[model samples]
Target: METCSLPRRKLAAPLLALLTTLSLPTPASSAEIHSYTLPQQAYSGSRERHYKVYVPSAMTTPAPMVMALHGCKQTNDDVLNDWGMKAAADRYGFILVAPFITSYDGLRNENCWGFWFEQHIHQGAGEVEDLHQIAQQVDAAYSIDPNRRFITGLSSGGAMSMAAAVAHNDYWAAAAPASGLPYSEDSSSVSLSGQCPGSATFHAVSQVVSDLTGEVDNGYPIPLLLLQNKNDCTVLQTAANNMRDAHLQVFGSGDFKTAATTKASDTSCSPYNQNNYSCHRIAYTQDGTTATRSLVETIFYDGPLTTPNAQDTDHGHYWVGGAEGNNGKWALQIGPSYPDIIWDFFSRHSRNGSQPQGHPVIVLQGDNPLTAELNSAFSDPGATANDLEDGSLNVSADCSAVNTQAAGSYSCLYSATDSDNNSTTATRVVNVVDSNSPVASCQKISASPYAHIGAGRAYVGGVSSLRAYANGDNVDIGGSFDTWSSVALYEGETGKWYSQLPAACSGTGGGFVCQNWNTTNLNHVTAGRAYYGYYTVGGNQYLGSLPGVNSWVKETASGYFQAGQCSN
Candidate 1:
């Protein structure tokens, strides 16, 4: 979100020309920021929405992608050029997309995204659908990874980023809403000149889940990073804190404490404070839990504006810590580059929690039906497999047990093996029922980028982790050890269940549970379970309303690697 200095649409002639020059994408022969217009298939208010994507030179075909939504009065060009996002693409080898509002004629000519518009925030509606369509289009054209997709925005765009994440939880692995107000149901958050009260934007923990009833109930569990600035008069720090707590409740996090504080001045990141903001990484571990888990983090800044060639420092609403020499309006060159910060968080996650590298990913071609009628014709829906080392592997299906002759349960195992001889399997349990009607799959979709924060973490020992997701309908949901009663890891393939860590679980609500260990001084966790809405509670198993993917991630390194997100 650029153009925070002075009034919107009132920029002088020379500045406008400079902005025009800066916003243009560099020559395609080098790196590129190509623009396109996507037709609006869902929304009636607008005919089409415009967006631009930046594909770095020599990027991998299935590289991750992030959608950067700009603030009102800002164009996609500002994001790619002014904010150093394009340059970051060169370094990170990831695609960057900036979405522009159909119209920018805002109140005071500061028009931006429709943060207050219900159509934009809710799914199956207007703008949110448009965004999803845009993402699907990108995937079709570029073959971007469905699991590693991300979304972010500034100011009003920030509000949309977080809000849209709620409505379309299945699409994004993670979301970073930077330098924006906590989103509830309010229009005041978009006011650049006035401070929006936190009460209007922040929701209580109890209300957070309730307020997001229809959506959260049927979507993937996604982690968030809320970026804020303390020195800004437009949006207050209280809003950021309220938002942090709000999301913790959404994630069902026990308690988050400030674990580390790093100033750009303390490292080589910002020796001269070129990026002048400080990041406070928060950890969810408290009460004797291992220290590696983090559900949500607040990358905040409270400092004098010393950006290289920034338009002004009066408003803290701009990108706080960005690449040096922003030299444009609405972005401060204070703090380390945010692209690295956001990318770090984005890299560790995908649509199904953590993606195990080199493993063959098997996708079921037919819907995993939960129920079938008695004495009926049953066909096994087959699957396909793709691996990192082996381009495409064959998936063998065994559905011989799926007999519609009697009313009971049947199972099919989809198996795939990569070139490295590492094998993986997906279990599809189809319930042969007493009724005549065909089994129906839930209309809503969901994904768990990480089944829980610790689902795919590479730690030395059994890691303390949390798996909290929307439990609209938990037929046989059991993993939620509402309390840290026992540490357990069950391998369905091996039919082996063992005690692994202490656990706390709360359910019939969100299937929320915590698996904790006393220390992080152990080896990489060998405990993980693949979920496809199938769970067993008290020996009775059930399928959830929102079925998800069954994928595995195997990583053996701690996730302290440095990375991008133009967060705050």
Candidate 2:
């Protein structure tokens, strides 16, 4: 909820530095570029174009597909050049497919997704059809799980993504639109008992639900992911919030306020509580004009999930899987690892095509390097409030004890007391390192003094690599053959830390250069620990390390925000 408008001095310094380094790679390089050419003229009248896809080797199975749509006046390559989806795909196996939208307003490649409800030469339905055909073509060629298909966009493309989802109920499993106009039509009010005819009839939000999954069945419903930032000027965050409540209602969830808080809550959902969907909303602000200031929020609804979002500080457009450019701002603004969370949701829920196993279970991510000690007084519910409420316990590992074979990995035994003082025992194998594990010590660097793009706009970069001192006989690091990477946020005001990289990046195949962003090379750090990792944004790549608290001071902005060594 805090807005970080980039200061003019800070902006100018970074921009100047970027101008000098635009053609050179920073000494701490973390990522490389991977490009993909679009199907060559699969259809006549098609434009000769190629899309750059970032696929991380961390992906094991053929991951889900995220189709990122570009905004008006933006080319697919430009979007790809900006979002850094390739880094996310490389960190996780999910496939990223970004489609190019041709420019219609005299700007080449500036045209947005075919306007469904907007004034345009192409009907929104036609645009949706074209997207569907492209997805079909890609699915046939690759091992994409169609059931886990997702779509997202920004500005015109953002609104278009929503409209496309509405038009093709059978195609996208879920959709998220950042800084775009709200649904031009009310979709929740319609009763989806019968066939939906005409665009107007399908406009209602509720009708979208029924059309996607036949029969308007309440017991089984598709999930919807919603990400909105407060204080957003382009597309009002408030509208996105309203849409969340509306979509929940369409899912047949009732309004129920929490006992402790006055805010209305819903029970029909998990991860993001039924009523407290706002809790999952990620908000941040920066300097710059309309194109640069906007941030992104990724939502995953419906079912069939995989690894959640992955984190990287890449300023490129491939920040989030298939979604790139303006969409990447929305993706990375929420920190680096969000794509992994999105993919996790896709892989876990897509295969079944039905509801999840039970109440949303919070599985602990096991990427931290330290080891955690379980409370000897463990019960059937484990320990702490989260356990009592959600049947899970999230405890930080002891950083000093990390690196042992047992580092970030521990076993816990639990016993329960019955009404008559009876006892039962339960054993659990806790994987402190959720995805790939973290390395012990590494030479870390950061973009503390990030470069500024313009008013309210700035770019940050950092990197981390294995340190010889941290990897000795004392450590047992054998999770993945590839190295891992991560990035964190230090509150400019509070001097606290926010875990930025959720998943580690690794390589699919080492080529002329090494690409390591996975468990073997890098591992997850404890929630409140300092670390480093590789970050990629579009064509720009850098190695960033976590800075100590209060590393930045609000000086006259003549120099970079200098930070000190992080401490406990």
The TM-score leader among the candidates is: 1
Residue 133 of candidate 2: its Cα lDDT?
A: 52
lDDT of 1 by residue, 324-382 (tens): 32645567554545665665556545666544345565655433444667887887756
lDDT of 2 at 464: 39
The list of candidate 2 runs beyond 4 A from truth reads 1-52, 58-62, 78-84, 105-111, 116-125, 185-221, 249-337, 354-398, 401-568
- Residue 158, candidate 2: how far off, in angstroms? 2.4
- lDDT by residue (tens digit), candidate 2, 275-381: 12232433111111122111222342221111122332121122233222122232332232334444444433342353221112232222112233433222222
Q: Which candidate leads in lDDT?
A: 1
- Per-prediction TM-score, please? 0.52, 0.41
Determine which window of 10 residues in candidate 2 has minimal summed lDDT: 449-458
For candidate 2, the per-residue lDDT at 280 reads: 43
Model 1 off-target regions past 4 Å?
1-29, 44-47, 104-109, 190-206, 253-275, 285-293, 305-313, 355-568
